[model samples]
Structures are given as C-alpha cells and as structure tokens.
Target: MNKKKLPLKVLKALEPFVGMQGELFTIEHPGNNLLLVKDKDPNSKFYYTIEKHQIRDGKDIYSVIFAPKNDKEVGAYSTTIGADDITTTFNSWVLFLENYSKVKSFFDDPILESYQAEFFSNFEFVDEHAETNPFQTAEILQLDYLLEHVSTRLIELSDENNREANEVIVAEIAFIRESLTNRSQKWVVEQISNIYAKIAKQGVPFIKEFWAEGKKELIKIGIKALIESAQNLIS
Candidate 1:
C-alpha cells in the first residue's frame, strides 16, 4: 500500500460509505495513495480495488479492478476512464458494489463455462465415491469454495419482500447443506433445480445464470458428487 494524502475532493467522495456502516458490507481506507473496498460478506478474496499507476500524460492514470474470485471479466475494468481521477473511480466503484448481486457477468467465467460444457458434455457420471474422480484436485477444491459462496449468496440475495420465496429458498439451501454433510446425495440435482426454479420465477438474478436454462452439463455434476469425487480428473 502506498502512503500519500488524497485531495480534499477525493476524501469527500469516500466520506459517506467509508466502513461497515453502509449498504455494502464494509470498506477500509488503508491509505490515501489507494482506496480499498471489499465484496459483500467479506467472503471472496476478489476485491474491488482502485490504485494509482505512475503513468500520466494529461492526468494520473489509475488502474481500477473489480474482479470477483480473481477471475477478471471481459469489460470488467475501465481503469483509464474512472481511475484517472480518484473521485470518478470512487463513484463508479460504489455503483458496482451496490449492484453487485444484480449483475450476472461479474461472476460468470466464460473460459470455465466453455471448459465445463466441453469437458463434461459427453462425460460419464461415474460413482462419485469411487477414487477415479474426473476433476483435478484444484478444480474439485474450487467446487467446494464455489459451493460455500453460492450457499451464502443465496441466503443474502433472497427476496425479503417476497417472504415465501425467501423462506423457501432458505429452507432449500439448508436441506442442500445437510445433504452435503451426510452421505445421502442422490437428490442433490433435484434440490438445486427447485432452488433454480424459484429464482427464475422471482427474477432475483444472482445464481440463475449460474444454473441457467441450458447448462444441463453443470447440473449433472451434482454438488454432492463434487464432494465424493475428489481425485484428479486426469487419473
């Protein structure tokens, strides 16, 4: 982290939501040379960061980053436009944070999706308990992390106004969690389908694309199976 004092305007821009006191979970002003804000629930290491770069033509060029899970999006960064001036960077970041859940692209991994589709499309569904797991150790581990994030995000993103929908989704996730801990997971895909259906109907768009209409391949790789099938894919 660089040590420097931000101009008064920049300071004023960040004054409103500077900590855990706002709509976004929490933010920390580690130093004036850069501003640091975290993604919701402080869950993922992927951060919404803005920092100054030492290249200036007419204005200071700052590199802005808002990559979730450290997987950068296609148009995820407009660093040159926003970060050239701290105030602009701050404002754009606030919008991204506030609307984080609504935006699906932030979490979409095109390369992974392509791989997931291509790899698993014709793949066999072996007994997940067998040692011959079809996923690499790292990919399998990521599934665990992805499961945790998905569970937390589902609860947080549930529609409070739609009490029934919210409660139903909550209950569904709880059951799914229980299945993960226990050995009985034959119904994992079914449960996820139920959750997906509710989300689609309500238009609460967090993980809908995650389990989108035609991504049956990913659905077949049941979360429960991911747990039992924990060996290298290439073995």
Candidate 2:
C-alpha cells in the first residue's frame, strides 16, 4: 500500500503530539484521506480518516472517522464537518485533534483505562446499531448550529468578565467537545437542555442580551424536535 502524505498544515498541527516513540503514517486512497498513529506498543493505534463527497446541494462534504485501537470488536465513530476549502478543512481537523488528544489521554492513564474501555464498547454498540443518521436529522443540525452560536457568544461574554456565566459556558463547551466523540442524540438533547435550563433561570432579559431572542427560540425548537425525534426512533 502506498503511504499518503498529509497536508503540511495538518502535519504541523500534529507535530507537538508526535513523540520520539511512535510512528505516524498518512495514506491517500481514491475514496479517503487517512492518518494512522501507531504507538510504541504495537497493539495500539489511532486511525483518522476523512472522505470528501458531494451532497444534494452540490457542496463538498467532509466526513471524519476516528477509531482508537481496542481489543474488543468495536466500529469507529464518525462525524461530518462543514468545510468549503482546504483552510477550513485544516481548521476542522485541528478542532478534531483537540478532542482526539483528550480521548487519547484516557488510554494513556492507568486510572482512566477501564473507563476508556467501557466508553469504547458503548460507542461501538451505538455506531453499529443506530438506525438513523444522527447528523442528517433536522433537529441535530439545528442543535449543532445553536450550540456553536452560543459557544461564540459565551466567549464574548467571558471576555467581558461575566465569571459565573463563563464557568457554565466552559462546562458546556467541555460537554460539546465530548459529544463529538460519542455522538449520542439523547445525550446531546440532555446536555443542550441542561444548559438552556440553567441559562433560563438567570432571567429572560439576560438570555436575550447574551444569546439573543431568536437564537434562544431556535434552541428551544431544536431541543423539542430532538426529544420528539428520539422518541419516535425508540417506538
């Protein structure tokens, strides 16, 4: 198999994480762009692949798949990133790398290994059996948009020194980061609802000024749509 070269930008972004002990390889095939990180332990490996294809709108779609080496029979988790060009593609990969590093750390720490294994198994099961495309749903797409908008506004609020709101926003950011790996619809609904409820308690005026009235309603609609969609999937 011919080894594919990763873009210079991606290689640079991954440089800090590359230690003296492991091997990094990239491969480009007709269907996918691949990056494989093989740890010192031969049994352990990390796979990151991106496949570009066209959607109904004639827009390019980049789908990312990340799978950690596990002894169990588990499939990889996948997600889509909205990217129109190479720069945006690189930025999306960098964002993914940030979360991938956190998940990778779980395997490196002895104390977290068990929990990591459990997470992998659960993730595999969900990936194998999920009937609906989590990303394709109108509700999920809306929720993703709302969360991103809120995240940006929260950063602005934080910069202004709203410490309490910043704290909550930080936690929400962490939750959103973790969800990228798990991709659980019910979990996404719960986390979004949790943040919405907490912010709601701070008063409508505060929410309006910070997150905006239109965005707030969009979140509410997104959450309700997700909850109902999940229920329909169950029945």
Candidate 3:
C-alpha cells in the first residue's frame, strides 16, 4: 500500500482553516493534510484533498486531488499558485467546499473518466466499510420524525430571495438529523440552536408550533434529552 502523506508542518498549518468546514461536511482527516468529505451516496462516495506548499521559488502552491478513497482509487489533480496570503487560502478552500457540495460529481466529465480508467488498470476500488445511511437511532425515532416535519416545512418556506440563508437552513437540518445517531444531547442541542437562529424569521413559529404539537409524541415515546433540546430550539 503506497500511502500518500503530508508533512507535519503542512498539517499543523492547515488545522484551524480546515476545521472551519467541519460543520458543513462529514470530514475525516486521520492525521494528515488530506480531508475526506463523505458523499451521501455510498456507491458514489468521493474525497477532496488540498495540499499547500511553499517549497520552491518562494511561492505558495495549492495542489488539489479529487478522488475516491484518496490514492486507493483514481484521482484528478490540479495545482494552483500564488495563494500565499491567509485570507486568499481561506477563501479558496471555502469556495472549493461549496462548489464541491453543489456540483457533487466530477467523474461525469469524459476527461476525469479517462483518468479513472487509467488508475483502475492496476487498482481495485476500495471496499470502504458500509454504514447505515439516514442514520437511524431507535430512541430518537419520534425526534427524527419531528425533524422530518421541520425539514419539510423548511422546504416549503424556502425563498429564492434568501437563497444562501435557505441553503444554511437546509444544511443545518441535515446536521441535526445526523446528530441523532451520535446519542449526544449537547451536539443535538447545538445543531438545534444553529438551525433555529438561521430560520428565526418565518421559520421559527412554524417550528415552535410544530414542536408544541410534536412534543406530545416525544413525551410519549422520545428520549428525554431530545425533548429538552426541542424545548431549547423554541425557547
């Protein structure tokens, strides 16, 4: 196994900036500059890695690799330069993350498909461990149902005039749903607060009333901590 690794200096420099994207993606670094953002579809799961360096000619070069399971499968590589300033680096990566999540598919291009065919000549697609998607937790079944109602209402309330806020609201709902599997009361509450803040206008009352009606079901069958989190979202 030829594992591609990044230098310790690069990893340390990238830590704080990389962490900012955590809330928006299922990120896994595993002690390197390589960042893995899990796709919702298991069969089409992919990763994006960015490496920053200033090793030659006193210029910063950002090298990006978009692939499946890093070097374990085929990849697309692009190198860019002069993104040395911190602000530039931050903006570049944030844009990359947003673009990646929106486009969601790179190998659809014939060029990228050719690259994959080349790599798979000797490489096998990594059999990444299967995970239960949509993240079901028995104890949070009622809370999950409540979140579904909330998500549906959010879509109904979505406005093209407030596209970015609508996007944030949608993403926050996803964070809230994924948090249910962790069984972490604190994390779920944090996500709830996040979603509530973004949707306070037009979105809050709907959630509040929904919670009012939904809490009865929660009280009957849901986890206590989740019940409290529901209260926190409205209060």
Top TM-score prediction, candidate number: 3
lDDT of each: 0.47, 0.45, 0.50
With a 3 Å backbone cut-off (N, CA, C), the pairs that clash in candidate 1 are 134-233, 135-233
Off by over 4 Å in 2: 1-141, 159-161, 177-181, 209-235
Candidate 3 is scored at a TM of 0.37
Off by over 4 Å in 3: 1-136, 160-164, 225-235
The residue-by-residue lDDT of candidate 1 on 161-209, one tens digit each, is 7666666566656656554433122233334444544554555354344
Write the residue-wise lDDT of candidate 3 on 3-45 in tens digits. Answer: 3355565556556644343433444443444444443322344
lDDT of 1 at 91: 57
Q: Rank the candidates by TM-score, best first.
A: 3, 2, 1
Local error of candidate 1 at 108, Å? 16
Q: Which candidate has the top score in lDDT? A: 3
Q: Cα deviation of 209 in candidate 3 (Å)?
A: 3.3
Ten-residue region with minimum lDDT total, candidate 3: 123-132
What is the alpha-carbon lDDT for the whole of candidate 3?
0.50
